[model samples]
Target: MEAESGKHIQKAEGTKLEQSSFEPSALSFQLKIGFDGKRAANNLTGLGNYSRSLIEHLAHQFPENQYLVYSPKVKSSKQIDAFFKLKNIELKLPLNGRFLWRSLNILKDLSRDEVKIYHGLSHEIPFAIQHTRIKSVVTIHDLIFLRFPRYFKYIDRKLYLLKSRYACKHANKIIAISEKTKADIVEFYKIDPDKIQVIYQSCDDSFKMPFNKETLSRIRATYKLPEKYILNVGTIEERKNLKLIVQALKEVNEAYKLVVIGKQTKYFKTVEKEIEKLGLKNRILFLKNIPFSDLPGIYQMASVFAYPSFYEGFGIPIIEALYSNVPVVAATGSCLEEAGGPDSLYVSPTDSTGLAAAINQILSSEQQQARMKKKGLEFVQKFNNPLVTQQLMDSYKALLNTANY
Candidate 1:
């Protein structure tokens, strides 16, 4: 699967000029790079993890370059604290009118900082970036609101479309987290496929590290986790399809329970009703506000990881589960196959029986579990920190090396 996806990624990148090997020392001078740091400082989920992980790895791999993280305000946490500890990274905050500064006024600061390249870690870049000397890049994580319009409010969809379309039209480069997202960008916004690059995301180092049995046991007791259970990690929402798992639990063995860890939305109430309808109130566990430090341990201790989300740009938890050495079973119809690789099991998002069978197959056979764990870990190394960071840096270098820039 790694080789197969590599061919697709290589083809996606073939449109770019100067497809040369990238080495930090080959450059004659240092570069100044800036990022839209809103999610890195404030968001703790998908976008935030993407921002922090990319910035951290870039700074580590190329310490000669300076990374400027610009945001309106920052919320302090252990993750943010560790991020600031990197010597090459500096955080920039607005003077006043926080929203206005990030949108329209930030170009003035970029000129003063001599930022050679500015990357929007989420779905937006500052307005009027094209008029300035800075080369801009924006990562469109997913078009979920556009793809599943029923899940979002009318006004929110309008706002998202406005910002995303403007960014796609104006930015020098567009980064899509998965090929699925890249295809969506071209289809929905009518952008040229050559203008976009598909770069996969990597999970945090915490998930890749080994934990002692005592640590795993402590986390198990802390969460009161079942001895054998299927783990699902993500927000509890309709698109996440938690209820499908609830319905599948009826077919799974009674000895195995379902553990969920995420924030709840109104859709959670609907899931609770399904649990009641199926008499699974006691068989399911919903955990919220779990600390980041304990998540890897929780993943390592689970019997199997299940993600039946109807759609996603790329499923980070699937890779996180793979890194934790847990077998993964995720829903089809999106980029999950790319994330989980070929060895991992996949089922239709709406097929509860198939999901149950896949879950039970792993739980019942130790040999099957071992084979998946080995192949999954080997396949996921393609998204390791060095490789992913270098791919991103190559994009930046390509933009800077362009004749127009």
Candidate 2:
């Protein structure tokens, strides 16, 4: 009986496809969506995490819709392959060519697949898709290249402006990860504010779960973690403002230490110079190549999490700290307030003295620590996967309902 029902449904779907070829009005039915999965397939950073989380949550929440995940070059990664295990998702690769396909030929594949909607999980959409029947959405994570142009090379900044402007102007709807990013899109591109939607991203569920004492013990021993420390996670770069944290440490109690976990770059040398000049070699530790699975325990064990970045689209580490029941101290110049919530303390990005005071307050007062932890855990509940998934589905429905598609 199940097999018979499946056959009937397949036949009905075939009929719908035939009708949609000639009439886009047929889009009122179940959606066939295409996603630019380049970051999810290749990166392990913010963009990749956003892509994976969105695909996983969307597929779980709305299994009736068909999803095609396309990449410039389809390679097998354990992270990407896990998403393919979902019966509703298919891995689509470039059919025409390589470099040119990103800029030119992906539109042909979208047409061939008969996708009603295409979403660029990163900051780009194929230029040709705007002229076709497919409605498109682009997620612009940040306009950092424009905001912090000093950090970007000349050619990189120009290309970023060109592609981001094209996507903002041409796509059916835009998803900005935070209100800061949405405002930047309007200010930099001179695009209408009504065209953008602000959506929040959260840390993985691993941070929310309780860590086993044995696992925590193992991680502590492996890293030789100090009993009391402030933790910061991100690349050791100037923009992340690790130097501010190091300077703050000098003013704090001698028992407290700072542990940072990220890959070292040339910027680390500059950071090292500051640390040495301040005679803080014993007070700071930089952990390299830590396994992803161990991050939760690391967060849980910290006395406080410090995120002193000068700017960001959103600070994922702040939410991670909240979920791990650790209090947070973050810089004030960007979207850190949104990520840190009301319970977390904020200080100027450049004020090492203010940062020191904030960290001292958390470290000294047990009552303050407990109150911040409770409020933060409650705040992060709004970003749970189920809620975020429903919000995304609503956007998809809204885009498809528009008369333009």
Candidate 3:
């Protein structure tokens, strides 16, 4: 049956493909959609940002449709607060079983609410959702845990594999954030390619907007940022390969400092030990608890942005930096090429000298920076909010239109 489904598969480059236009006015009625809201409401990292941004854009673009976000609890943050203020979005919580509701019992509430489409914003959907009338869609962000097993605990890898395989097998449709992820799903889980749709995600709207010099200066003063620095963002973890950037700083110009912003993990000690060995304590600055609003200014003021992650489902920071008009130097082994586009420079993840050369190549030449900035801005427009939201809404409508459903 899965092989039969592969017959309808179409080739996709990143998220670009022929898609039917989404017109809310042409629709007979409004859509009542449900999403896995745990990350949207609580997580402060990549998954959370993806969830919040997608939901916000969908709401803004399709106000007539009803959005139901289900989560066990909500945390108060500037982003979350702003999300709640938007019209046409409602937060749903279980009356009880808050602990296991999402995994074990959320389907009951989904059925009761008559959610026409249920999207698991993260990987897994509730078990037995295939038996329900609600058409199910699951977004498989990445198979990083499977790709880089050494970075994760043995049990964690097993659990991730189990849940992801189950989701791919059961969900009526799958949304792959990148073409690479779509390929990984087919390769690892043996799922039908036709079952997956590539839909790129956009960064926060704040990154796309311009910040004035005064506002940038205020952010610089607040963070005590250096006059010139290279920026790297994402959780400081083994797979993120922050250590590579730390090593490359040895070869980069002494005048340019490296600013690291992220939630640190045990792997940070490994990077710190390398920093101590290299005697770069004064050359590196690590910032924590940065407000989301201030991130754009930080990126805008940077000399260059560096991301040497060993692997990713999709690299959001590359687009964020591109939108901020900063040239990017990202690692080459994974899907960074797709996110960075052809204009951004790439180096091997383990090549410290090459990475440093790429960074310096951008910083030392104004002409090079301007060209990359121009081309990157042009490439990133394909991931804009309206186009991405339309693709998503069209996916939902297409799923509902299927006669089998």
Candidate 3 clashes: the total is 0
TM-score of each: 0.91, 0.91, 0.91
Query: What local lDDT score does residue 194 receive in model 3, on the 0 to 100 scale?
Result: 98
Q: What range of 10 consecutive residues in model 3 has the weakest lDDT sum?
A: 1-10
Whichever of 1 and 2 has more lDDT, that candidate is 1
Structural RMSD, model 1: 8.9
Off by over 4 Å in 3: 1-29
lDDT of 2 by residue, 163-209 (tens): 98999999999999899999999999988999899888878878889
Clashing pairs in 3: none
If ranked by lDDT, best first, what sequence of candidates would result? 1, 3, 2
Candidate 1 lDDT, 200-279, residue by residue in tens: 99988889998999998899999999998889999998999999999999999999999999999999999999999999
Which residue pairs does candidate 1 place in steric collision? none
RMSD in angstroms between candidate 2 and the native structure over all alpha carbons: 7.2
lDDT of 3 by residue, 1-405 (tens): 011110211222322122225544455447799999989878877799789788878777777787788887777655565675554667787766677798868988898888989999989998888888889999999998888888888998998888889999999999999999999999999999999999998887789889998999999999999999999999999889999999999999999999999999999999999999999999999998898879999999998999999999999999999999999999988899999999999999999999999998998999999999999999999988899999999999899999354
